[model samples]
Target: MLYIQEMHEGMKVAGIYLCKSRTAAVTKNGKNYDNVILMDKTGTIDAKIWEPDSAGIEEFDALEYVDVVGDVTKYNGNLQMSLKRARKAREGEYDPKEYLPTSDKNTEDMYKALLTFVDKVENPYLHKLLEKYFREDAAFAYRFKTASAAKTVHHSFIGGLLQHTLYVTNLCYYFTKYYPILNRDLLLTAAICHDIGKTVEISAFPENDYTDDGQLLGHIMIGAEMIHDTAKEIPGFPKKLESDLKHCILAHHGEYEFGSPKKPALAEALALNLADNADARLEFITELFKANMQKPDSEWFGFNRLLESNFRKTGDLNAL
Candidate 1:
């Protein structure tokens, strides 16, 4: 079995992988090919099925497992597979869990750390609102521990939501410490609950695609509505506090172009936005470099709009 990270140009790979997606297309000269996404436990890679009509091609769809034989090639510094043969995997051929990546952090440890923040929240109404989702709600707790932060972004794996929430919550803790003006209770509570709607936004594993609500309202809107509903259930939850909390969730996206419904009107909202953006962008860059590590002396990493610079990871120029 060839781990995707170890693949190099012209290397042969044979393994059972999940067919994340498959798209048929034609080149400018009318040559047909298939653009596919293949996934194993490590990560996903872009694969081209040049011989889609070949005799060995399998009848399969995204989410199905298949045994694939391919030549590894580097495309713009990222590994891409050129499939020579593929067939739907039979029962006992592969374990589904092996095809899904999970956070290295312990889920239980992450959840318990989050609970400490919930305990320290001073505002009664905000505390209770967070409790409704994080502490008392058994089902939401179960899903949150298992859910991914995004279907394909930072923290998009099992235990990812918990890992990301822990990081953002920790960020808020330090933010409140540094800036005495920031609302510790409001920021911490908002941190824990900001992405709660993502539980419903994306489907559970093996098919972690967008749901109907995820596509229509998105996590930001759905999360705001969720907080509003929960705030109503709590007795004497201040209306203004409820509004501010929702503002944090809505404005957490930070900028209008990034889909934030509102800019960070409150200082606490701004803090949460920065924390969220930092975690997401850092994780994305880390994953990008991991995928491109095969080429040490590489030039530009193509067009990575997120990092803004294709920071070249050059080989040991110091060696010579």
Candidate 2:
């Protein structure tokens, strides 16, 4: 199969791909075209179907598998597709794994490491809540293992939630040593559970978009509600501890403008929010550099939202 990453100008491709998005619009000259984004494990490529009304082109919604015939061309130094013929693929036409992106880390191993943190937690209520979702609840376990951390942004892949959670928990563990003021049990518990709401907020593979509940209430709200309900089930759980844990989840996004209903009110909440942003912004900035490096002989990079300004990495690191 001709992967998008392997594509070059003038190469004709005939293969199956997942249609990530499809939009139809008329040009100023009145010619209609199907502007599309096609996806595979190598990442996404923009596609232009020049003749949308023709019989050769077929209807396929986003998330549907499709077979395409097109010439790969360079647009702004990136490879793009110009479709001569395309149609929605029939069942048995393509492998499902080929379309989805996956994490480099082992999902099972990552989950196991997460449980070790649960074992280390001294609070009985926090430990029990962690177990209910991570081990005891079969459905939640399946979704947590399968769901991506985000639709785009950072950690958008299978096992992404596990990877992100583990990273945050490790950071929290170290934070406990530096800041003795932050309670180890409370801080680590919040770290483990911070993004657990993503299991409900985002649907599993082939449809990783926001769910109805996710759209109506963001992950922060969903997580706070989940923690509140689970805390109630545990007898003798400290009221102050419950509030602190829930605050960490609520403020993990950092500010209300970013969907954090509350800013980091507790010390643990502030620590968790810092860890989350550290992972996210670092990944975003790294991708920005990788994208620029892939371009032919490219040197000076330009405005990247994650970086907040234009930057450059020249051919010679020492020359800078």
Please list the C-alpha lDDT of all candidates, in the order they appear. Answer: 0.87, 0.84
**Position 282, candidate 2: lDDT:** 67
The alpha-carbon deviation from the true structure for residue 273 of candidate 2, after best TM-score superposition, in angstroms, is 0.9
Query: How far in Å is the alpha carbon of 155 misplaced in model 2?
Result: 0.6
Indicate the worst ten consecutive residues by lDDT in candidate 1: 311-320
- Cα lDDT of model 2 overall? 0.84
Clashing pairs in 1: none
Once fitted onto the true fold, the runs of candidate 1 whose alpha carbons sit more than 4 angstroms away are 23-33, 74-78, 292-303, 312-320
TM-score of each: 0.89, 0.87
Q: For residues 87-161, could you state the per-residue lDDT of candidate 1 as single tens digits?
A: 999999888878898887889998999999999998989988878888899999999999999988688889888
How well does candidate 2 score on lDDT at residue 240?
Answer: 83
Tens-digit lDDT track of model 2 for 113-159: 99899999877888888888788988888888888899887888888
